[model samples]
Target chain A: MNAVIFNGPRKIDVEKRPKPTLRDPTDAIVKVTSAGICGSELHMYRGHQKTATGHIMGHEFVGFIEEVGSDVRSFQVGQKVVCTFSPVCMCCWFCEHGYSNRCPEGLAPFGTQGLAGGQAEYVRVPFADGTLKSTPEGVDDELLIMMCDIFPTGHYGAMRAIECFRSSDLVNGNHYTDLDSPKRSGLSKSQSLEEAVFVCLGCGPVGLCAILTARSKGVRTIYVVDSVDDRLDQAAKLGGIPLKLGRDDVQAKVMKATQGRGADAVIEVVGNNAALRSAFDLLRPCGVLSSIGFHQGDLPFTALECYQKNLNINLGRAPVRTVFDEAMEVVAANKEKLASMVTHRLPLSKAAYGYEIFEKQLARKVILVP
Target chain B: MNAVIFNGPRKIDVEKRPKPTLRDPTDAIVKVTSAGICGSELHMYRGHQKTATGHIMGHEFVGFIEEVGSDVRSFQVGQKVVCTFSPVCMCCWFCEHGYSNRCPEGLAPFGTQGLAGGQAEYVRVPFADGTLKSTPEGVDDELLIMMCDIFPTGHYGAMRAIECFRSSDLVNGNHYTDLDSPKRSGLSKSQSLEEAVFVCLGCGPVGLCAILTARSKGVRTIYVVDSVDDRLDQAAKLGGIPLKLGRDDVQAKVMKATQGRGADAVIEVVGNNAALRSAFDLLRPCGVLSSIGFHQGDLPFTALECYQKNLNINLGRAPVRTVFDEAMEVVAANKEKLASMVTHRLPLSKAAYGYEIFEKQLARKVILVP
Candidate 1:
């Protein structure tokens, strides 16, 4: 089986690796049809995150189940499915409590440790019943692939920001939409959602998805900040008000847009100190900052800064398995946008090119067909 | 009027200061009958917080409305009322949005800036209708005074933790209490609240109030951490499982008590990096950390730590005015316990002694009669 292997820093190689087989009864072998070269992968490609040599390099993929272990009751061979970035045990306290992202028994992001990833032609998916979700009928492979990771993550960040705001005293006098009822999901009786201003820092794939998610959830104004002009243009195409970093006065634009109140919510997808600082500065009192970035640095703001701003910070990896269904609904709702999100599609042999374009931020999203 | 003035570090003096008079159309001059030395005041007393010489030293008080300005329609002269620690302008965006604690127009804690402290014979309260709540007819001045800051602060910490938990997917399958309705505010349909474990760092006034508040809200097990045995004993008396820092293996105890799940929630009232570090180490994945402490230090945890733990942190000053009515109900329900909370009562002339005992953790709470 041919696979994209992590050789070293800024190194990639297409090599013939042994085909994966089910290690546990709950495991299944997924023949990867389509996989994404994520922005997170850039962290490893750029040597930001340590990666072992010969490790498979993708966590987002959509394909058919080539084989299923006897214990895998929910899926069968030939079933079309999407795999979550990390596998969950499904019965751990965190998994039972709907926080599968932190499942103590198993939350290893695929392609790391002993778990090989989906960039290969065949990959073993442990806890298949918990990790794999069937693609909705009629959805394209690329659109369903988006639901595998970044889309759900972006959706979760946006959803969490809105949820935090909805449960706050900020919405006390204002009529707001209830997310539980799909028929009445967005702004309805009140224009508060339309009036509420949001900010998304970074215009990467996940940030673009956050913008789309915010729009679908009835947020009328989203000030998207990014350094790259191409990414900012993509955000603007998705209806986000783009603020180019170091070029535009980001804080002034957000404050002006929000009537000097700052943003009601900020979805921070850029996992750096500067982005976190901007998030703190661009939020109003009692504002929610939902950070979905895979940050490695210490928090930029002091405890006093958080208190004075009365900040509510909800941050973590998206529980992809938990929010899969809802994210699919969002994906289904914005199928066209998701389709356009894929800027480049390449064969498994062209994985190096995919990595290069993605690392340079020249491509919005690159899909590799195996 | 005689008042407790901040002279210098560890130097408190009872001095004759001019009696405060109504200064604005919404101001009211209160004849302070009782004022309590709070944990927050100790910060300024110890010079941790900058305090000007001759600054009056208390923010918690129960008094009679001696005089009301023309715009103070809700508060009448001679009405018994409890004044919030900080006065909030009723018309600010934060005040209208339910975050009166961060009211940009007027969140200066009384005793700071131009606002005279309440530890005097008379104190002027701006936004009288917004800051003062009428005391329950039969409640003791001391118990109602508790509602001014610490009690509501503790209650807010507990409530915010519970609210954050309730609105999460953790309570999806489990039946939980609804906070809006007084009748259904605690555990009812399920025993999850009883099974849930909470941790409170620091067993001073606010931490003690947190224990009582958690118990009142049907949280059966709370591990209260403190270095002082006296404070731990007070927490034990209020149904908390006391954990003495340095004396006990705090992390081991919490892990054992929670089946290695850490704490379901952590109410951090100690305004230091150590307490914040303890909070991060003691919380389970997706646990809520409600910090009502006035911390000046940078956050102890890194963004990676927060992300890895999937933490939800709600930190700020308690909006005493916003939660005034609810806290009064908590106060009314636990009046007997609250009565025992005030371990020392001193005359205005003995303010120095009161500050000494309270600063040394010899007193659970100190009330000064003016």
Candidate 2:
């Protein structure tokens, strides 16, 4: 099988590698239909993260189950499926408590940690019964691939920001009883997202997806910030108000647009100190800062700043499984709008080129079809 | 009039000062009946915080309305009242949103910023209708003064931790409707504190008050961590399992007690990096780190650490107003247990001596009576 592998810093290559096999009864062998080049993968490509030479790369994939372990009762051969980045055992303490992202027996999705990359002929998936969801009939490969990572992740970020704001509202009112209803999911009916302003930092695929999710959720005022002109242009084309990272004074622009107040919620998809600081500065008092970026070091803002602003800082990996079903509904409803985000597509053998263009910020999303 | 002034670093003195009068239509002259020396005041006393030489000091006070401004229609002269540390207008955006702690028109209670200290013959309170709460009939000065700061602040800390935990639970479950019930206050009836293990990081007056509040609210396993033997003794006396800071391996102790699961919630009252780190270490995955300590610099933990642990870090000033009424009820019900926390009392003229003893950690709480 031809697979993408990490060669060295700033290096990636597609080379012949041994095909994956079912190693455990709970595992399933998947024939890759499509895979995504995630922004987090760029961290390893640039040596910002540790990765061994010849390490297979890619975590997001849509595929067909070629073989299923005996223990995997929910899945069978030849079924189209999409799997989350983290393979979780549904019965683990963390998973049962709704924190599948931190599942004790969790395995990193297809590419890293000695797992064969999904940008290949085939890949092996563990905890197949819990991690892999059958692709809904007739959904396009582009949309299904998104369910594997970016879409649910972006939705999780937006939902967290909105929920934080709602929690504050609960604190201010006597409507504590409202929290019991499932209807209070992300954006409630009474609380229109159209009335709140959302700021997305880093117009990468995740950020763009966040903008799309916010729009589909009825957020009217969406500001997308990024250094890349092409990404900003794409954001503008998708009903977002684009702000150039260095050229536009984002804080000043957001404050001006909000009539001297800051944004109601900020989805920080770029996990760096400057972006975190900007997100903090762009929020109104008691606003929520939902951080989805894969951050390495300490949070940039001081405890004093967070306290003085009365900020609610929620930090964690997105439990994609929690929002996967709902995100699929949104994607299925707005397939055309979301399909526009996949700007580049290539054969699995050309994954090296995909990494090159994506790393340089030359494409919104690069889909590798195997 | 006589008042306690911040003469300089490590210096406090009772000096003759002009008696305050109505400064605005919403102002009221409060004849301070009692004021408590707070742990935070020790920060200014030890020169950790900048304080002007003539700045009046004291933020927790209970008093009688000596004179009411014309616009202050809620209270008449001789009405007993208690004021929170921040004099909020209640009409500001923050106040209306239930974040009176960050009120834009907020003034430091009693002292700093030209507001006269409550440890004086008379203090002028602005935003009288909003900031001053009428003292409930039969509530003693000791219990009422507790409401002025430590008690509510401690409750605020515990509530933030519990609320953060509750909010995380909502994220994991389908109980969005549960948030609407007032019964979903801080500690839900279904999610009793009795089942959760709580760790209070400091044994100051506020931390001790937090233990009492937690106990009154049905928390069965409460662990109080502090360095001072006397403070730890007091905590033990109040039905807490006291752990001396340096003598005990705090994290190991907590983990051993919880069967290696760590604490369910940690109320951090000591606002420093080491204490913050300890609080973080004592929490199990997906736990809440509620900070009530007045932290100065950046959070010690990295964003990656918080993310990996799935931590919900709630930082901010205590919205004392939001919980003042509720706290009053708790205080009235547990007056005897709480009054035991006040170890020393002195006349207003002896405030200088009170500050000396309190600053030296020789007393748990010092009440200065006018």
Candidate 3:
């Protein structure tokens, strides 16, 4: 089978790899149908992440089950399915609690955990019963593939941003009167998202998707910030108030827009320290900064600043599988707007070119068809 | 009037100062009946915090209103009251939303903002309507003074720790059916504090008070860590399993006690980076690290580590006013145990000796009566 392999810093190539086979009874073999190159993948391709030569390099894939181990009950051979980037067992403490992203065995992406990548013709998926989701009827391949990672991830970021307001409401005694009623939800029902002002940093695919999710949730004013003109243009096209990163002082602009008040919530999709700092600066007192970016090293903001602002900094990997079903509904309903995210598509043999185009920021999203 | 003034590093003196006059329409002149020396005051005493040579020191005081400005409504002259360490204007956005600690004009801890401190014959308090709480009957001076800062601060830490669990439940779907019912409290009614395992780092007055607050909340197993024998003894007397810091590997002991699972929640009351790191290390995955300690610099844990463990790092100054009434109830109920925290009492003229003894760790708490 042909696959994309990491060959060293700033180098990748198409190479022949042996086909994958199910090694566990709960495992199943998936025939690669479609996969999306992610921003995180760019980290390894640019040598920001340490990767050994010939590492199979894809985590977002939607495919058909070609073979199933005997114990795999929920899935069978020849069924169309979409797999989460992180495969979960569904029984671990984290999985049971909807934090499958932190699952012990589930942390492994398709290519990085001694498992082959879906960029190949065949890949063995462990914990098949829990990890694979059947493609819902009426959802196209692009949307299904997105459900594998970025779409749900973006949705998770937006949800957490909204949750910040809900938490504020909880503490302020604005809502939640009954402590005994099992029917009571923690967040305020009367607080409409239509009143929230959201700021999205980075304007990459994930950032753009976050703007889309915030819009769907009825967020009123959405500000998207990015350095790339193309990305910012794309964000504007999708109804975001696009702001060029270097040209505009984002903090001043946001403060002006909010009438000297900061944003109600900030979606920090850029993982760097500067972006984190901007997100912190953009939030009002008691506002939430939902960080979906894959950050490395220490936190950008000091403990003193966090305390003074009374900020709720919710940082982590998105529990993609937990919100997969809900995200699919949103994606299915807005298929055209979301599908527009896929500006470039190519055969798996041209995976190297796709990586180059993505690395240079020449395309919005590049999907590889196997 | 006499007040304890910050002369220089490791130097303090009781000096004569002009009697405070009501400066604002909402200001009140408080004749401080009793004031407790706080751990944070030590920061200014040791020159860790930059302070003016003659700046007044104390922030925790229970007093009688000697005089009230024309606009003061709720507070009356001769009414017994307690003031929060951070005076807040309750009408501000942060205070209105239960984040009084972040109020713009509220960060003024009686002494720091050109406002006189309560460790004097009389202190002028700003935003009297919002900052001063009328004493409820049956509460002692010691308990009321504690409510000024440490008691509510401790309660705030415990509340944040429990909130971590509630947030986990919210995402896991173990509880809360409605995401918007508004009738739901932030925490789970069914979950008993009797089942929670709490670990408190630092055995200072605040740490000891936190242990008391956790106990009042019905927490069954509490581990208190400190190096001082007297402090540890006090913790043991307060129903905590006291662990001396240098004699034991605190992490190992806690892990063993929790059956290889780390503490469900950790209260970091010591404000250093090492203590913060230990608190992070001692928590189970998804556990809450509620830091009430005034930390100076950056966080010790990396963002990647926080993400991997799914940690809720709730760091902030306690919103003392918001929880003042609730803490008063707790302190009043546990007066005996709470008052025992005050091991020494001195006249305001002996403020220098009080600071010396408390700085040397000779007393658990020192109360200066003016």
Q: Which should have the higher lDDT, number 1 or number 2?
A: 1
Q: What is the lDDT of residue B34 in candidate 1?
A: 95
Please write out the lDDT profile of model 1 over residues A301-347, one tens digit for every residue: 98889878778898788887777776787788777766778889899
Candidate 3 lDDT, A90-151, residue by residue in tens: 77656765666666777668767366777777788999988899998988777787888898
TM-score list, all predictions: 0.93, 0.92, 0.93
For residue A12, what is the lDDT in candidate 2? 78
RMSD in angstroms, all models?
A: 4.3, 3.7, 3.0
Query: What is the per-residue lDDT of model 2 for residues A141-177, given as tens digits with 9 covering 90 to 100?
Result: 8778888888888877877776666666543322233
- Candidate structures ordered by DockQ, highest first: 2, 1, 3
Model 3 spans > 4 angstroms off: A172-178, A182-194, A233-239, B172-196, B236-239, B257-261
**Residue-wise C-alpha lDDT for candidate 1, range B1-370, written one tens digit per residue:** 8998889889989999888876789999999999999989888889898857878878999999999999988988899999889888867767766777777756578887567789999998888888888888889877877888998898888778766765565222221122222122221122266778899998888898888888987789899999999889889999999998888999999999888988988999999888988999999988889898889879888888998988889888887777776677778877787778888888999999999998988788899998
lDDT of 1 at B54: 79
Candidate 3 lDDT tens digits, B181-229 = 5333332222346766789898898888888878766677889999999
lDDT of 1: 0.82
